[model samples]
Target: MNKILRSFTLFTALSAASVGVHAGNYWTASAQDGWIDGYVEATLLLSGNLDASGIDTDVDDGTVTLRGKVETDIDKALAQELALGVDGVIGVENMLTVFSPGDNDDAAKQRKLTDEKVATVVKTRLMVAPNVTSADIDVNSTKGVVVLQGKVKNDAEKQRATEIATKASDVEKVVNKLSVSE
Candidate 1:
């Protein structure tokens, strides 16, 4: 009875070891190269054919995860298709969401109008500033955030431009990327 019990225990251990080996081999086979490679390839593939501005991608092992909002259902499906086409991508987790048309349209339009107003106000302020040169400055506003880009003669001019932008109505933030010329 002891001999039979010993044999049964050994057989059970062997079976468990074989199962582990098979599982390891299966995982290795599925993950052909690396997750990074899969991510890059999928990104390039999607970017080539799509606008790709709002789309984001993540890869784990052989599975690809796509996230972000697309304009339409067609765009969402296209993004998934592009991701799946990549080599070594065994599965695709398509988590892309479509942009809501009715609600988003009104909000986007309002935001754009607000941004335009902010930019115009900032521009007018810069023009009125005695020491600042408004000709070379480029003003762009998005969602109350103003981006001032161009060249300035000195640090004072950069500071003045930022101040002007920050004072505009509804201006939430100001990004001054103006280069001061020596």
Candidate 2:
């Protein structure tokens, strides 16, 4: 019984550390969303039941929006299930399109992959940008076109986000829909 308790404690500590939480430190809203995003991505990638390469996850207020393509409807359902299983996720918006090989050729698959990559890169760049508050920003991509949505501090931040997104590889255009908060 003592050994089991010790192991459980260790596991809890590791889990907390994995999510960037330390003792006596609370998770901010943005931190929680970041953790949820990473958790959902990891969960889908590790599921082994789905391809996950074309998937992109965005978390806002505990709701996860899953975008991109999957080979089958089952894969789409599985991705949503896996995302909903994450501890902080309250809802899942499955925007995953079912890829029909007969309808889509290799070029289509490549375009989907490129879109996923663009979204990921843009989101990552926004998150790391010092002047950008990326927590409220949501990134989406379709066929190399990137869309930025949500709120930012000011026009500068919004423009900075657009510039950052436009710099991502394979981004043909950036449609900025970010509203400036008063």
**Model 2, stretches more than 4 Å misplaced?**
1-105
42-138, model 2: which lDDT tens digit per residue?
A: 7677554468999999999899999998887556766776676566789999999887533334576556645555565567567767999999999
Global CA lDDT of candidate 1, please? 0.70
Off by over 4 Å in 1: 1-105
Q: Can you give the TM-score per candidate against the true fold?
A: 0.42, 0.45
**Best candidate, TM-score:** 2
1-182 per-residue lDDT for model 1 (tens digits): 99999999999999999999999987776565455445434343424334567776776776778788777655565566555544456788888788743343566555654555456556655765789988899899887789999999999999999987886667899999999988
Q: Model 2: which residue pairs collide? A: none
- How displaced is residue 110 in candidate 2, in Å? 1.1
